[model samples]
Target chain A: MKTYTRPLDLKNGRVDMSHGSGGRAMAQLIDELFARHFTNPILAEQGDGACFALPVGAGKMVMATDSHVVSPLFFAGGDIGCLSVHGTINDVAMMGAKPLYLSAAFILEEGFPLADLLRIVQSMAQAAREAGVPIVTGDTKVVEAGKGDGVFITTTGIGVVAEGIDLKPSNIKVGDKILVSGMLGDHGVAIMSQRENLTFETTIQSDTAALNGLVATMLDAVPNIHALRDPTRGGLAAVLNEFAQASGHGMLIHEKAIPVRSQVAAACELLGLDPLYVANEGKLVAYCAAEDAETLLAAMRAHPLGRDAAIIGEVIADTNAFVQMETVFGGRRMVDWINGEQLPRIC
Target chain B: MKTYTRPLDLKNGRVDMSHGSGGRAMAQLIDELFARHFTNPILAEQGDGACFALPVGAGKMVMATDSHVVSPLFFAGGDIGCLSVHGTINDVAMMGAKPLYLSAAFILEEGFPLADLLRIVQSMAQAAREAGVPIVTGDTKVVEAGKGDGVFITTTGIGVVAEGIDLKPSNIKVGDKILVSGMLGDHGVAIMSQRENLTFETTIQSDTAALNGLVATMLDAVPNIHALRDPTRGGLAAVLNEFAQASGHGMLIHEKAIPVRSQVAAACELLGLDPLYVANEGKLVAYCAAEDAETLLAAMRAHPLGRDAAIIGEVIADTNAFVQMETVFGGRRMVDWINGEQLPRIC
Candidate 1:
């Protein structure tokens, strides 16, 4: 309970081994950095963990986890901090649940700048606050200098699904209509441009935002939606393929209808990457009954994060579970899973 | 749904960027290693997250997280994988909860051997199985070759406490008794010996274990337990200081009553370390009413993990909230907070 003799030098200080030594230094760092930004009653208790009553009518609990090792911790539109929070929240939201809490675990390299750490924590707090989900618990560990990059953040989210809303890959029927929440590949292209130092006629920014609110809007309009997922690491190609395989069906989509901003499309073309295989951080693919497709699309398009929502595909019967796309050039090609590493540390 | 053309070469394979790209290689590694080991019904779904019904009587949920960055991934008695599981489980159990599930997120360094990764995952699987807590969800990310050490594992646990049990540091009264579960410094000494290449007359092993069962037994007998915590980092001294600070009281303990194995004590002595500030992986400290201390100690001793349980200290009224210990030679010394790092990456 005794305060440290000197305050942390956030302006010019750097993380050291003592910051993670489970001693006074660690306590000081927590009090000054983490607890200050993530100000919540539960975290203020500073117990071994956070304990709270599960929300009532919590028919089922959803848990999701993601580890962000994005290079160049700061990106165009977002940094790893907010991305870490949004990514896991979207995962839980994909299950037709309301995300309630998040737990963050940070692995920081020794000698990393404390200023950058503070910035990241502040962004995370803001993102969590905007999403209405507090980061209730967290942990911090420091690795030796060369043993780690600047930092890697792992976030786990807990959400509660309402009684009658069940969204799963198995629920996708052969005739379900497939719709995308927004444009594809903005996140990947933005990160790629930053890494390659490429200049484009137009600037590209990562489409990293929490999708829980958008998902809630869509689900409210179409509660019986069959399945939903965010196209993150493996992009739309991976998600479609996963759904096809899980449902023992095939997908036939119109590439022309899939929303892709011209800048992202041009960037992917110049980089020799398929937009289908590029990541999207703030977008989702939803499957619903054919009769409800228009209603669901209207709901999604009304949300800012899903303004470009479009129906791009429909499920079909195919024992092989192939995802065939009708190209914009009036041809068809199998939009297969990504073959190898198009991008590493792309979040 | 289609299997890879070639099975993963688990023996000679080294993780490359492709293994974490959310592509075929990543799928192959997951299918061949992680899925094969941590086999459970929930993880088998392989959704974005795992969704399950909360336990019916789940009065409140407790969540805890820890990131493991221990040096020499493998040690005498445990590896980072099992240590990560036991550490978080103990945290949740310290709150008088029954740990129900765990989520693991791994940041693997590129070029790390797949064999070692498999070993760690196997150990994690066995530990979770033995503890009766399933690893229900997880994620994996790869960093460029030199950007990271072999691997860092972060585990988050979710548990449900019974209706009447409410354990928090604020519950510690001025007259509460403090008891330690078992011998101290075994874990720290074991790791120190490995790092220092010190050969002792007696082999010392890390006391890494899951203490949920032991916690359940003790709580069953003493539902009114004031406070409980596991002394991991910063050891017993840190726990006492934290308790004193949090409860606005001082802690006075008899050094003679505290148990320390001779080998561990000798190792600490040789290393110029104090047993009081050395970590223990599988131990806990509990606070109870003075009159119930004997019953609590007896209940703890009846459990296998608490064979050496002893009432080592008592909370006293003190304005400064200092933690003082009575030495065997009739001298009193302040067991103050650790000011600097004793051992880095000791966890």
Candidate 2:
């Protein structure tokens, strides 16, 4: 039975096994870190699960989940905290749904620095608040040292689409156009640069940002959008290849039209990698009819996240459903689905 | 190009970093393990997110999430997989909701055996099927060796409660009767037995099972149940204490009336642990009107999950809101919320 008037030791303290023990220490940590940062009415209720009132006709609800095990924990543009929130939010937005709420589950390693843990938690809160979503519920666990990294976050997002909006790859037609929101490979390169033994990076920060606002703006201009996808894990190439197979249409792209930052491009060259197949955290790819492409591009360009947007490719009729990319030197090469892992733990 | 006409090497294979690379290896792992087991219509669509149609007036939806980081991977009666699914399902059911779907995310260690991973996945699929819920979406990540345990899973569940059903600790009244579903301390003992340095002989095993159906059956019998909770992390003592504080009332319970297996009781005695504070994975405590207590007990006893249901406690009016317990030796003691962690990583 003791009381003290000192703040939590987040500067030089480490998370021991007791922080996640579901007792006084765990409750104290939650109160000082999670509850203080994620201050919303729903989360404040602090029940076993969060409760919310859904409107009568909110239409289809979409759920997406992603586990962030990114190396280095912190990167140039963002850390695992914000990346976890942004990743799942983008997944929900790909369905043309308004991201509504999120749940975060953290697995912390024993003896991890408490200061770093608080930093990540605040970053997640900031990201969720910026996107107008709340971390309504969460769970935390701690494993034995060496049994886990500093922390791994699994974020699950729930969103609701209006009654009339339908976005799916099956809606792609032969003459549809493809566009990307911004440059690719920055997020991946930023992490690779910080990895052990890799050291060639020149201001190639991660393009990690929540793209739900951009999606909403695009929908405002083109409600009849065909398909939308975030070029995340396998970059623009992975998303485009999936779209081709899902839609049963061939895709032809001009490599010169694709956006790639000069620094990231130089780094890819030094590492003998393909920027087209690298990862992105904030960019998106959209497929729409030829008539709506210009208007959608204009709308996307107006958004800060999609300023460098361009129509990079078009859908075509082909029985083989190949994703063909015209090289900058004028030869066409088949951009096949990656055979193995291009980049490990890219997201 | 190498194609092997054989199944994946679940027995002898180790998970490399490539398994989580979001490329061909990752897709193969999903197809071979996760998709093959969690076969449902919505999951087969394989979009970035899972979309579901919500009826117009389906009432309030409840979402719950939990991360399982149990040590020793496999324990008596259940492993992390079944535990994860049961844990989240019970959370939603505690709100008197019927679980509809679940999403799982896995973080695996780089060099963990593939066999263990598959076993956990299949167990999860079995648990979901038994609960009549589907695993509609999932994500997987792998960390470096020594950066993770064998695996950690986070399961998030969504459930919908019918109109006119309300269950909350806030509803408890002074004369309300408290009922427990079944035995306690078995699960905690079972886990402790398998810890690195602990060993004992006992038939007490982890009581990991889905309780949504039991919740439904009880609702059919007594729709006016005031409160519901599963004694998982801090056990029955923790739950009753929470109820007493939340309802602004005191609680009185008889130690002799509580159900505990003799073997489990012996284990607790040997381990110097109290049965009231040990966790139970598949038990529930219900608060209801004193007049309806017997009928509700009868209804619960008819269900397998609650065969040993007993009325063990009652709510009382006390300004201090203390949980007073009457021991078998005819002595009274105050059971307070645990101060520090009673048990670390007990769940």
Candidate 3:
């Protein structure tokens, strides 16, 4: 048996071609570093690919993929590792499904610190465990230094949705109630502050989280929910506009009802940003029947992940399919769709 | 009817924040640029997202996502636009499925040319239509100039695999015949020739193509194929090594049995690159039972896209899981996995 207690020389060492050479050096690195940290039955098999049995079911499977390329790999609350897992898992959950397996492909830049890679892989493993999702299959490729940033992660998730539950944007109807899971703009603001070298008296942490539990609760309360969307990149306003346009209906959101933490609001105000258009990693937007709105809100609030849940808007019949918001002072304005990238490289 | 055409000053125009600000300018850009080129029933609906009915099926659905960030957006044989669509569609098809729909997300640099963007979008539409896949839903964001390369495309594809087709690496066994779809190194050599400013008497064009049609033919001929893989980034050697390790088998490939174009070979030689390890955009590696090999090979050769198909190797029981080649000169050497990203951003 080989003793494996050596500390990784993360500081001085740089990733070389050998790391991807598919030789003894590559195998050793995988065994001593990645495999050790991401230990699981499937990954430990040490095969070129993972093989496992899928649960027997007639349910429809939902799959989604997302790539993470946020600058400054490490952020206030999460790094690219955790973001990679969270982003794809959220995408799968948004389809009203239970996420099962995840496949990750890493594009690593040569000269990247091995210790840093270990940390990221470990974080991804931890996130997967917490989300109750397995990292089943993966690929790793190292690009030369100048050709890549520190790291880029592309994650694909597969999930199964039980029959009789067909969720679609077209399912939304006039008078549908819209509810938000929690505070907005935290993740976007936290990343921006770190990247722009801005600081405030009160620290802002990213709301990077897995929302499958919250989704499960919402589904339990209202099985026929119209639609579920995670307001990630382009935030609340963008999601609402998307829903309205997709369903061919207008939306009326109450600005006072949408949740935004004070710190996020302050940061946005100082930076001349709109919290509504910023990103949120942990939060979700759910549209349901007005009759089931309270039941859904209560269920969301009951979950730890959705403590700040609130009824933010309602759907309306309009060919224009506009998304309008009632201001805190009672003025109505359009909460339009975002046209371009908000904060580039935002996961 | 309104008639309108404008000369685009790509060099002088700079994108302001309003381009993504969800205002009139954003709407105009989308209508005049993106929507114009990507005109289709699903996209023309102008919904925040797309809604369409899936073909009736109890078949399993396969989905894959890929991000394209190749430099010199327009390459030797294809641009980043078509590459994005082709890459993900091939990923889904490699599972022995018929690709259905695609979703694209664009991250455009602030100063990128609208005309260039339109050209790319047109190419994407053409490729998607040619591949029999629809671009259903998409998201676009513009990053500030220094924050990103000119453009990055992330494409997601969804496909449906027929019933009873169980393809997996675990299905691979000793004595399994290995097949290469067509010529190798065309894509890598073409891109490198352009990148390195190397000129040759014969211009090397990339073999960038959609392989779903070829896959369907092979599947119809030999339904019990063990595994199918595309030799893309790290190329034939990487994929073969992966399959060998996954199946716990060694491989013996005859160099003469592999197909390569003369120009590609010359380009690789000049660059001191191995054709075995160089990428091929439209090629595949199929491992199947020896009994079905002839049928599969005939089917592949019949396809216009796979006229150069060849039975290159066979799987052998070995704990080492090595990939070895029998050279044309009767010499034996290892055909190992790639060490690093060969020709970064080629795809």
TM-score (0 to 1) of chain B, per candidate? 0.98, 0.97, 0.93
Q: Chain A structural similarity (TM-score) per candidate?
A: 0.98, 0.97, 0.94
**DockQ of the candidate models in sequence:** 0.85, 0.59, 0.17
Candidate 1 accuracy as TM-score? 0.99
Write model 2 residue lDDT over B1-347, tens digit each, in one string.
11224667899998888788766677778878898899998898787888999855657888889999877678889999999999999999998888888999998888899999989999999999999989999998987788887888999988888888988888999999999999998788888888888757677789989999999999999999999999987789889877887788999999999999999888899988888988889999999999999999999999999999999999999988889999999999999767656666776
Q: Rate the local accuracy (lDDT) of all candidates.
A: 0.92, 0.88, 0.77
- For model 2 the local lDDT of residue A181 reads 92
What are the runs in model 1 whose C-alpha is more than 4 Å off? A196-202, B196-202
Error of 3 at A27 (Å): 7.8
Winner of 1 and 2 under lDDT: 1
lDDT of 1 by residue, B1-347 (tens): 55888887779889899888988788777778887898889998888898999799779999988889998799889999999999999999998899999999989998899889989999999999999999999988999988999999999999999999999998998989999999999889888888745665348899999999999999988899999999999999999999899999999999999999998888888889999999999999999999999999999999999999999989999989999999999899999989988878988
Candidates arranged by DockQ, highest first: 1, 2, 3
| Total clashes in model 2, counting residue pairs 3 or more apart in sequence or in different chains | 2
The docking quality of candidate 3, as DockQ, is 0.17
lDDT of 2 at B253: 97
Candidate 2 recovers what fraction of true contacts? 0.73
Evaluate fnat for each of the predicted models and list the values in order: 0.89, 0.73, 0.05
Top DockQ prediction, candidate number:
1
Task: Report the lDDT tens digits of candidate 3 across residue range B126-224.
Answer: 999899898865655555565556777777776677878867777889999999999999888877767645555347788889998899999989999
